[model samples]
Target: MTDILPLAQLGRRIMVTGPTNAGKSTLTVALADKLGVPAYHVDLFRHLPHTDWEPRPTEDFHALHAAAIAEPEWVMDGNYSEILPQRLARATGIVVVDAPLLSRYVRYFKRTLQRQRVGALEGGKDSIKWDMIHWLWHTRGTAEAHRKLASETGLPAVFCRDQRDVAALCAAWDLRLSLS
Candidate 1:
């Protein structure tokens, strides 16, 4: 939380990274809600029309992300490799949302099932398929890779390993803003 204060005070662009179902979207939305700034969910930019998992063109993805981060205040959420350099370049901070592997897998399963039952997914996309569940599990390694990348990118980052840390971070962020 202390690590986040400076970035929030500065109103810097940020990228929230984490494993699937680790609450990256939740945290990004919360931050944007608190700061009253725009938050871009990269999934919105990535997912193609009428397709479940097909990604958009690389050029289009970069253009879209470039446009989003061009703004003064924004928090972007995703782990698209093609956009990482530009994202890291513009990011004032990074928050890595990490939870235990077992916990994350359970969350992933529950979320996928919930989405399927509701016929809704992120970005108004259709419910995810069973194959997507396998993809989510594979994403576990990507989260670790991003943690390393964030460390090397030199952005001020806060890694929350569990729900307690997440709550603590939110509470501290609230306190900081109140005192400010």
Candidate 2:
């Protein structure tokens, strides 16, 4: 696996994957800022307003994703497994932000609370459904998924095993944010 920081410099199209609250958004935004690239967040499209995750139609989602990936330089972060191959085929670099399940639990709570303090989805309320946790529990650390992401992308892999891994990359690249 390669260090992620260098990938930011080399990759014109980047894909970042991880369970929610693993700093996927933060990294995507920061990398976009530093590199003067565009960040396409899948969640912003996956989730529809006020209907509780009423997913956009599959074709619609793919269309939107494809348009962004068609761009010569862009970054996207999310684990939309159904469209993994589409993303992988277009990715110039791939990153997986991994952490212990316990750590993910803690971060989820913290992030949920922070969202509550501020606001929820711009068009929806804060929702931390039991089903969401269940989904995370089942999906969070699937080795098969990671292997497939790496194998299909053919881009070198960068795995951030903990917060420190992300932090080190930020520091090394002189990024303005801290993983903390």
Note the Cα lDDT for every prediction shown.
0.70, 0.70
Candidate 1, residues 1-180, lDDT tens digits: the string is: 234454454346878888766777777877787777897888767766555557788788778888998888887777777778888888888888877677777765666555431112345445546776787677766766767877897767877777677778888776221110
Q: Which candidate achieves the best TM-score against the true structure?
A: 2
lDDT of 1: 0.70
lDDT of 2 by residue, 60-117 (tens): 8878888888899987888777877788788888777777777877766776655532
Please, what is the TM-score per model? 0.79, 0.84
Q: Can you list the residue pairs that collide in candidate 2?
A: none
Error of 1 at 120 (Å): 7.1
